[model samples]
Target chain A: MERPTLDQIWAWLDQIPDPEIPVISLVDLGVIRDALWKGDTLHLKVTPTYSGCPATAVINLDIQQHLRANGIDKLVLERQLSPAWTTDWISEKGRRNLQKFGIAPPPKDGEHGSYGALLGRVVECPRCGSKTTERISQFGSTPCKASYRCTECLEPFDYFKCI
Target chain B: MADKALFEFLTRIGDTTLVLGHRVSEWCGHAPALEEDIALANTALDLIGHTRMWLSRAGEVEGKGRTEDDLAFLREAHEFRNYLLVERPNEDFAVTITRQFLFDAWHRLMLISLQESSDQRVSEIAEKASKEVAYHVERSTDLVVRLGDGTEESHRRMQHAVDILWPYTGELFTDDETDRELSDRGIIPLPSSLEGEWKTHVDGVLSAATLVRPEREYAHKGGKAGVHTEHLGFLLAEMQVTHRAHPGATW
Candidate 1:
């Protein structure tokens, strides 16, 4: 069989959506750090969005099933922790997709402090595009998101909180 | 000696988080409000997540085939190395918040100093951990201030929580041989060195909360050398029952 190039592997990997957030691909989520061919085996590096993310295992299994389906059997997935995954790595496309899915994406500049939520900074609601949203809680249904309610739209939404 | 020290250091943080995480999870359905409940559960998740990183490193340093699961689930109470503060039962909402506030304050300082560790692995883990912990500290502080300044009953409970937990804070800064070795090797900060910053941060929060600091500087010790409070055994029994009964069992 002809070997799949790194680019081809990444494209295949991108086909896998984030386990919790289905709207965005794992590649767009930036957890798929790198992929390279080590002779016959494909070496892939992934980082978790949060240390205790329940989706970490599911994401790994999904990746394995994904690459295997693509006919690249020799594979190794390494959980890289040094750089640590940050919301900053979410691709521009991923942000747009998250917003379209009714979840507010994190700001691009990431200037928001860890205590940014306490300061009453505006998180524009994905639904109405209103800048009048208030955080309902620091946590949401998953570890990576915060709950916000828009006064203008009267809708509760998830904010991909900056870590 | 170095690997032994590293294992000791890692397990100290690892086991502490494991115990506290489990305790926090106990509040899943029972917290004061639904939002607080979800917040506690997520906090527990983050702590357990950190437990994996620290215990994984400990297992590597020990060079044993034991995984993070083994380190977390298989160890007897005496074999555990977490501080006494974390193992205490979550007596009430105030105590839980106060306990979290104290630990988060110290934990933040510890992780910050660790970011400069001579060991890159240590620094990297600390760097990543520091970000998550920033959120923990902020939330706990807000709760403490709110409850402390809120009402007569809440104010009394918050103050009582602080008074009761204050003694344990000293043990957090007490340095021993394992700490001395790690600090000497530049792999971690000396526990005593972090005390100043911890106190400063805690003092600021306590003042803002209108809670007074306990005058006593005396502290209970011995968690570092494997000695632990009786509370740990019960907590462990509940936590380990599932794992022990079904060795290597997975859903």
Candidate 2:
């Protein structure tokens, strides 16, 4: 059999939705960090959305089972802990899907000031593109996100941590 | 360093980080702002990671049957050797921030000194945690100034929190025999040396926040001796119940 490409592995794994947030795929959530084929066995590197996240084990099992069901019997999942996962890894399509799923997408590019930037920089609404958003909490539904309420849309949403 | 002394010292450090991490993790989904929530959770994660490393080493040194989880969840309230400062209740955001700021300041000095510890494992954990604690202190300091000097209501709350927490800060610098022995053997930071540095860092932040540094008096000690406040029992009851009930239960 011809070797499966990274793209092929990603496509196969795209069917794996996050155990907690089923609305989004693992790829969309940027949890699957790297995938490679080693002969007949496939090695996949995954980073959890948060440290000690309960869903990581479930997600890993799901990935292994999903790939096995697709005829890739030899599967290995690697967990990487460093250079921690960030919201910036979320793809544009993933952000759109997040919005469609009613979870506010991350802020658009050039919105909130980067780290070391001066404070008081406003964070805009991921929905309706409104800049009049008020922070509801430093915490959100998950450890990787914060909660923000949009004045324009009158809705509360999770803002994926930029870093 | 003597094996027993080193073992006790490591356990104390591990216990402090672990309980404090547990306290901070409670705020995971309940912060007043999402950004701050993530930041706080991340900090908690860092501390938990540090706890794991330190506890694992402590377990190794003791050569006892206790694993990290065993040490963490199996210990009774009085058995835990965390500082009194870390065990204080998280009253409000102001109180939490104040507690963290004080810890971060002391921790930075402690870790920096431990970076030169004779024990390789202690040095490694301290080196890694020092970097993370630096960020925690910086963020807490920034928030302290903003809230302390911000609106009238915020200033009042921040000041009140500071006043309430100031007493606990003294115990952080109170070197007992364990600390003295460790410092003598170069296994840990000298409390005397760290006090000045901690004072400078904390005083600078307090000054920026327009908050007064409370004068030192008879500080509450004995958490190091496993004598905790009434709050610790409840905290441990909640934390250790599952582990104590199951006894070696693993998922």
Candidate 3:
């Protein structure tokens, strides 16, 4: 029997959509922390997108079913609680994917300088890449996001709050 | 006696969280800012989660048919065992922040001790809650210093809140027979031991805020003994109404 590769595990995980945000896969969300082959069994470590998030059970179930369908039967799912999840964990590709999917990605830290001086910040529109944008609400779709409206495109989008 | 005692201890813990969570939840729409509001609400949610866990465990240990909801919502004013510190109304943002600072300081220490509890379930819950409490303490301490030293009016209000709440702080360190048993068996740490650490952390923050710990001769007690202030009944009335009115109803 040959050892399974990371690519194989990644491909298997691609089938798992975020339970809360169905449009994105766990891999795209950067929540599939680690994958390893131990003996004939595969071990996958995942972190919840948010603390006390209710979607963890669904995510776990999805991962197990997806891996099983991909012919990896022996599986163990582990949850890492510490170090906490941050918006920075979302990858560049994930950001692009999120934008294309009509959900705005998290803003880069210090991009707006200090949150203390809030008005001068230039938030780029996720849709049209326009630099003119204004905050709609400090809170967005979830506790981890803020609502913003693009001045140029006039489309409202969610900006994942900096953890 | 043993079963009743266990139920009482568990209820004390649950009621403390429930009442404090209720008070904290009021900050939801009225916090100083959106971020602070979210933070306070999240903390309230965490406390409510802790209350559910402990109350459910209490129900199991009691061998009573009562579920967590029954214990939470069906209980009368005198049935609650929450400390007076958490039962106090949210006077102002300063009062809320000061109350939180004091409670979080004690809770952080208590949770740290509970993390090593011999009871595996207790230890597990404490381990998780400790992290959250640590953050709560940090946030509270930061706000205390900022507001205390921020402006003349802010400083006066912060100091006044601290003075008013200091009397309630002593009761948290007063342990009863249940606490004694749990501490002796390593199921929980001694409340007295946690007091020293709590005091050190609290004093450090107070000093930075240029606030002095008030010297009070009378410290309130008896919450753990099923005695609470006039506030508890009203709070419980609001919290328990829905569940008590519609028994065992779940959506």
By TM-score: ranked, best first: 1, 3, 2
* lDDT (0 to 1) per candidate: 0.89, 0.77, 0.76
Backbone clash total for model 1 is 0
Query: Model 1 chain B, poorest ten-residue lDDT window?
Result: B1-10
For model 3, residues A59-155, the per-residue Cα lDDT tens digits are 8988888777777778888875443455667778777777887777766673321213333456677789888888765544454455789998799
TM-score of each: 0.96, 0.70, 0.71
Q: Calculate DockQ per candidate and list them.
A: 0.61, 0.12, 0.10
CAPRI quality level assigned to candidate 3 from its DockQ score: incorrect
Question: What is candidate 2's CA lDDT for residue B28?
Answer: 79
lDDT of 1 by residue, B1-251 (tens): 43887888899999988999999999999998988999999999999999998898888879877899998889999999999999988999999999999999988888888989998878888877877887888789989998998999999999999999999889999988888888998888888898878888889889999999999998988787889989999999999999999999856
Off by over 4 Å in 2: A1-7, A37-41, A99-118, A152-154, B1-13, B24-66, B77-79, B90-97, B104-160, B170-210, B217-234
Docking level for model 1: medium
Give the clashing pairs for model 1.
none
Tell me how far the alpha carbon of residue A14 in candidate 2 is from the true structure, in angstroms, after superposition. Answer: 2.7
lDDT by residue (B1-251, candidate 2, tens digit) is 33888888887888999889988888978989767778788778878877877888888888876788988888788888899989899989999999998998788778778878887767766655664565566578788999988899989989898888888877777777878888888898767667777788788888999888877566888888898899888888888888888978986
Candidate 1: where are CA atoms >4 Å away? Answer: A111-120
